[model samples]
Target: MIDRSLFENTETAFELKSDSELERAYFLFKMISSEPLVRIGTAATNFALKAHLPVEKLIRATVFDHFCGGVNEDDCLPVIDKLYTKGVSSVLDYSVEGKSVENQFDNALAKILKIINFCDEREAMPIVVFKPTGFGRFLLYQKKTEGVVLTSEEEAEWGRIVGRFDAVCKLAKEKDVEVLIDGEESWMQDAADDLVEEMMRRYNKDVAVVYNTLQLYRWDRLDYLKQLHKRAKADGFKIGMKIVRGAYMEKERERALDKGYDSPICENKKATDDNFDETLNYILQNLKDISVFIGTHNELSCYLAMDLMKTHNISKEDNRIWFGQLFGMSDHISFNLAAQGYNVAKYIPFGPVKDVMPYLIRRAEENTSVSGQTSRELSLLKTERKRRKL
Candidate 1:
């Protein structure tokens, strides 16, 4: 087992103050802890925003600070530099969600291309990330999977999605930056998988320029990973896989029930955890053909990967194995891993306050829901505050 002292040292490094910032974080924690209010209010706020209400200021002050890098790429530079100074790398994510317009899709694609270009210019920014839904309508993605032929307009939208991905991958290849495509809802996943497979086939021959995110919480993903490995081996290319425990559990379960289909989600958290660790072991064993980014906050999972690395005599700087957490959560895991000479990056999302509200709310809600995570953070902050005698 990894020593508990590692976490203690990691928490101390943050040097948190017991001032207004800590107080605000506590308040938000309490608010999100109120399960009834969080459920009702999150739903209501999502609805209100869809109805075009003005709540950007509130979002920016609270959850945005806790999750997003900033409002745009330029806005993210200082934060990226700060992480670089701390020996942590940044994966730049443009956090816009749930759009259906062609122009909006095209704009998102253009912005992602620009981000790729920016990362190319900045050596510190090693990974450029995107969600396919950001560049294509969710409904269109669903329809495409259902064997529905697209109309001319829909075909044009599909072209835009392809164009966006191609542009990002081309820039990433040129700049030698890895592009990490995020996982999405099960219904929309087929389209994402198809697109990512195409990109991998085209650009992953030399190095892993494109990565497909696999959410291990899905019951079928382990097998899917194996199949992808087979395809990559047969095609004579490296496969880059970013593994997460998934984020859309509740939504997926509800949708599965509503649509009268079996849920694709793992039966419980333990099952998911088991699958995740097993998948990590598989990837480590197949390190020659696969590059893996272990995007997790679980300490055991992190150590499990480390243990596999040691057993296999894999170098800490292999570049094929990486560890990542989101920007605000799991600093102990991310910073400590990096400090210990492992490749670690934080998933730093940035966008307009209004556009990133969903992402922020998810972070807030996740902190409150992930067993002891919020309490652990609060306790650490308080301990650091007391240590500073504030």
Candidate 2:
């Protein structure tokens, strides 16, 4: 077993932060912890960006700097190297979202190909990630999921989407790097799943070069995991599964109500947490057929995986299981795991600041620790600050 004080070593956790930066992080987290501040700040920030105001500087210095790696791939190299020094690998995520055109699709494809090619050379970089909606049009994918018959133009658009996907997967296979297909809303997820499944059949025969994300907050995902494992054994291909608690909670429930369909999400956070842990156990039990990236911020779940690894006598450096956290959040868990010799990676997202604002706002709102004591993030910062006496 690894040293447990690694979790309490706030000095290492905040090593990259200056005293001023630490204070700013505390102030920002405190602001967003209040529901009213987040609501007003989100609206005002959006308005400023849209109205050609100079809020970009303030934003770049605050949330954007904290959550995102850089404004583009080249800009992230320094950050990537910094993480590597402390034993954490980087997963370069192209963060541009909500684009829907052939050129944009092509650009995203080329960008991911660049990431994969870059990963081919860097030991510090492990896996690469991209969302289905980043390049493909959301409405078109939603229609395809709903089984709408596509006109010829829409069919051609689908072809472009498929080509872009195939191109990325093929390169990943050739380069011997894993590519994670990030998850999105349920309405369009089936289309994305179908595409990822096909890619797996083509590239995952010997090893898992392509991965599909499963959000365990969905009530059906446990059964879905069973079906996937059974199919993988029958079909003779490994399944690369990245598991997370769902992201689009309110959006999923709201749309289900509008459409008069039963919601796909778990009824409560407890159910989601249970299902996530159960899914993790199921995957670890069947380790040969399934490889998982435990993409979570929950501390208990992380420790549970550690205990399971110890029970199974799995090596700390095993390639089949990984721990992933976003770049800025959960530093104690990430750096501590890395220091303990586990395979740990940070999802390093990069893009134009405006294009990445949606992602930043989501991080801000989701991380607010209004329920009780400070958030795991805020408290860690406080601990580090007190240790340094800055």
Candidate 3:
């Protein structure tokens, strides 16, 4: 039985950061907590880059440095070492988005292989993560999901995409590293899911080497989980999944409204939360055949997981369950969970400054949109700052 107040210890959570780092985080969160400021800042940053102004260095030092590991694999070694010192695992995510060429796709696959090899040696990096859109054309995947038959050229292009995915999973199997395929916008998710299921069917026979992310904000994901579980169980394989509230809510609703179809997302925060918890319960009940990754920032959801674990008599250090939060946010949850002997990991994204800008922008928008997320983080940082007399 773990104490409920375990996450209240801010000192241990912020111990790795210096006084200056904490101060910078406080100021950054304060600026982004306001929706209007985040809106203006994003627009200004985009404009500055377009107008050939010198903003990359400033962004690199501020948000990029705060949120990302570095611009490359070698740059992430030190960050990995630092997190390992605190008993937290790192998932190195090659977070460059908006590329669809075959060359770029191959390059992404190669870098991911490098990451798998890097983790092959380091225990701190237990999982590798990359989104399907990073290596596949979003439009092509969307059309495929819509049941459109591709022409010969497009078919060849998709063949290359599948070939790249096969290489990643094949190497992951050999290297003994888990690869998490991130979820994307609903329009293209069906194609991604189909491909990911194929990967899991091929690679997850003995172990959960490949994971598919499920967004609980969707209205049908709870049922989807049950059906997937049935398939996995019958097929004699384990299923790996990362559960989240999702990232593309605004765009999802807008697109559904534009297309004259019902929105796939939940109706409200309560509905999302309820479905998420129920899904967690369902997964927990089948822990022997399923590996679940809880990727959330909500403290209540975290507690619910803990209670579920206790009820199911699952050990805290069970490798089948992992708690993940993004780097530079939710330190209290990440660090405290690690301290409690739980299998905890942090998502550390790395790439070139320009390539990673989209991820950084999403982080800013998430802080602004998620109710009181930035404010709660700021409060914890302020408390730790005051405690240290910084």
lDDT of 3: 0.91
lDDT of 3 by residue, 1-390 (tens): 557887778998999999999998999999999889999999998888888898889998899999999999889889889988989999998888888688888889889988999999988988998899878799999999999999999999999889889999999999888889999999999999999999999999987889999999998988887898899988888899999999999999999999999999999999999999999999999888889899999898999999999998999999889999999999999999888888899999999888888889999998998888998999999899989986
lDDT tens digits, residue span 221-267, model 1 = 99998998898899888889999999999999999999999999999
Indicate the residue-level lDDT of 364 in model 3.
Answer: 96
Which sections of candidate 1 miss by over 4 Å?
1-4, 10-13, 16-20, 37-59
Q: Which prediction has more favorable lDDT, 1 or 2?
A: 2
Q: Global lDDT for candidate 2?
A: 0.87
Model 1 scores a TM of 0.92
lDDT of 3 at 120: 92
TM-score of 3: 0.97
Cα displacement (angstroms), candidate 2, residue 203, comes to 0.7
Candidate that would win on TM-score? 3
> Model 1 residue 115 lDDT?
85
- Among these predictions, the greatest lDDT belongs to 3
Candidate 1: RMSD to truth? 2.5
TM-score of each: 0.92, 0.96, 0.97
Global fold similarity of model 2 (TM-score): 0.96
Clashes of each: 0, 0, 0
